[model samples]
Target: MRLPFPSLSTLPPTLAKPPRYFPTLISHTSTTTTPYYRPLSRSLSHPSQPHHPQANHSTTPPPPSSKMSSPAPAQYVTVTPTPSGYALLTIHRNPVNSMNTLLWSQLQAALDRCEQDPNIRGLILTSGLSRPVFTAGNDLTEIFAPMTSREQYARFWTVSNQFLARLYRSPLITAAAIHGACPAGGTAMSMACDHRSISLHPASSMGLNEVAIGIPVPAKWAQLMATLTGQGEANRLCGFGKMVDAAEAKRIGLVDSLVDGEGKEVVADAVRWMEKTLRLPDVGRVITKAHFRDRLSREWEDEEWLRSEAEGAWEMLASDEVVTVLGGVMQRMSGKAKI
Candidate 1:
């Protein structure tokens, strides 16, 4: 029996246009026989496919793109300050704000700016993408690309985890105004915040369901989830990679509050909440937050260890098992799109 798939004219919003951050591959053929081979857009020569262990031999993937050494975009995130003594840092890598090295660096910079500036008392994280998504997740291309070197993956991991560590431990009051479908990295960032105020829109949900994508959630992520929802619930949720709606999230402590509308209304509610919180004496809040969250944050502190972990990430993504699983997933989606 033929599986149901989207007609060519009716592609999903995510598949309609290629993601800018993860432009590691571009379709070069429509033939069903193209196999699961992914030709790296940057180094098409590699024409990489997972070296299935069952095969007698396979080609080694090439090094990362030369463009990696080039300067990244000056503004990958935008900082918009409000009169409410809070600033909104909109992840500006649009189409889908998949956190890559550039986004991580830019986000770190934006956070630094907000904290250093006397005018900004707190900061909120949101998305600049018009779509109802905070972020799809970390750009998987770094792992999936044929030209992805271990070093490159290491850099990507280090930069992103560092930013996340900082976000978790930020001195300024932090909040995530989750406006849409948040998964994986999006949920991690939201968890990093002091409060998660989410939109009640049906399109909005949150989860650490990286298992669905064949990704391993870092231990720290699960630890933080446990901190919020308790060890039993965190184990159940992360173990299954389940996504939860706003109501369930609020009830489970995955989210602190829910706003009635999406977009500006939700952000406004978060700002209002932040304003009220800012009224409290600042140092007490900061230190108290540190007391509870410091241990988890400290796990990501060592740059060297993170780099070593990145090698493991490279192995996981490029492994025979992950490649086969993710390949099947991509094939189904692309096949659906082509139909």
Candidate 2:
């Protein structure tokens, strides 16, 4: 079904009102500092002016320069507008586009902007790098770090859940153009999209590899997997953490279609389908999709998947075996440890 795009210039008057504020009571002090009420008046007097605060004897010490000068985190995901009114978001982080915390946050922000933009009718999610790997999944280095805390892990998982959930529920149609290895969280990402077009390269691997990392499939991942390949398939895939080749993925319906050769044509074909299907008069496609998937997502939301992720992260961090195994994998790959 075709969804009408909202005009930005014609937004309702209610949205143009002054920013709302919540009232808070502040404790009074005898210190000779400018009162908050006076600052409010000054702000009203010169709405467009900037004010620099002067330090007083009783004022708190300024935070270190390093803190003030810290740069905003870099955006790992790149969004490019296409002529087809759809955008392509490429996860460009090198050999394996592992979804680190920074990448996850960036992805959410990109999706948010795309969803709000009237010109963007749909989106094609893919990696920037060529095949042999689309994404190897979450950054094992971050996941297996010694200093990683349960709270941090939980926050990471929560972020991932929110990002994936939004993609699944986006008002615009979404498609995943996968070329190479997409394991663990990567596979979950493809499944979250409305359609997945994969390349049939021998090197391409796809599956849920969470068990290998010693974590049970969280509710969101499990639900998406189940949606793509039934409960039985999802159970086996998650339980075994098996990585399937491209051919096996298509055979089992894990992937919607396999692109010939290197899969460069996959995105073009997906774009064609999106253009045709998105124009359908009936909005049932989008409505039905949301109806079916929202039920499962709600179950996940109720379970508090973020909290579970944090707990799992804490447990994984506390495990010397997990740390040793991950370190050994990295060292062996680098020729610093015996295989």
TM-score of each: 0.75, 0.75
How would you encode candidate 1's per-residue C-alpha lDDT over 160-209 as one tens digit per residue?
78778878877678999888888888898899898898888887888889
lDDT of 2 by residue, 1-339 (tens): 453443333322211111221011121122122222222110011123333446665456566678455564555687787766778887877657878777777777677566545566678888778646677787765566564666677777777777787677665679888887888888888888878888777778889877775556665687677777789988888898788887888877888777875656877767777787667532444445555565565455443556765676567666888778767666655732111
Off by over 4 Å in 2: 1-68, 301-303, 335-339
Clashing pairs in 1: none
Cα deviation of 140, candidate 2, in Å: 1.0
lDDT of 2: 0.66
Model 2 Cα displacement at 147 (Å)?
3.8
lDDT of 1: 0.71
Candidate 1: clashing residue pairs, number: 0
Model 2, 22: alpha-carbon shift in Å? 27
| Model 1 error, position 58 (Å) | 53
